[model samples]
Target: MLLVAPGPFALARTFVFRRYLTLRSHVVRPVAAPPVVDAARKARKLLKKRAKEERLRNFFGWCEGCGAYGSIF
Candidate 1:
């Protein structure tokens, strides 16, 4: 059996490759939504939630005492 160590160029290439991988992994990516976009998203979410509650209220009945929808099924 024969063993050979990596040459200087091979070591440098490996170092650069490892450094590139580290830099790529440590990159900070900002995921920020604009205020207007955030507000619109919240509004859409609220509307969807309200629509779901309304559907449930209509399918069941609004209990005036408990202030919740009555489940018939």
Candidate 2:
């Protein structure tokens, strides 16, 4: 059997090609950020909740002592 020694440039080229293949295989993509809630949408939801509570309080008599709507029979 004959032993063949690889040249310095051959080893360096192999290293560079291996490194390039590894880097190309594993690619990192930019991720999107989480969605944000604007103030107007928050305000609208708050107003809707307040209106619902107000309507419920009106339908059922408000109990100041309990701090909620209470029914009196």
| Candidate 1 lDDT | 0.79
In order, candidate lDDTs are: 0.79, 0.73
Those runs of model 1 whose alpha carbons end farther than 4 Å from true positions after fitting are 1-33, 62-73
Give TM per candidate.
0.39, 0.34
For each of the candidates, give the backbone clash count: 0, 0
In the predicted model 2, the residue pairs found to clash are none
Q: Which ten residues in a row have the lowest lDDT in candidate 1?
A: 64-73
lDDT of 2 by residue, 10-47 (tens): 97899999998888766654444434346657789999
Q: Which candidate has the top score in TM-score?
A: 1
Q: Write the per-residue lDDT of candidate 1 for residues 1-73, one digit (tens) a residue.
A: 8899878699789989999998887676554669978998999999999999999887666445345544533
Superposed by TM-score, candidate 1 places the C-alpha of residue 41 at a distance from the truth, in angstroms, of 0.1
- Identify the runs in model 2 with alpha carbons over 4 angstroms from their true place: 1-37, 62-73
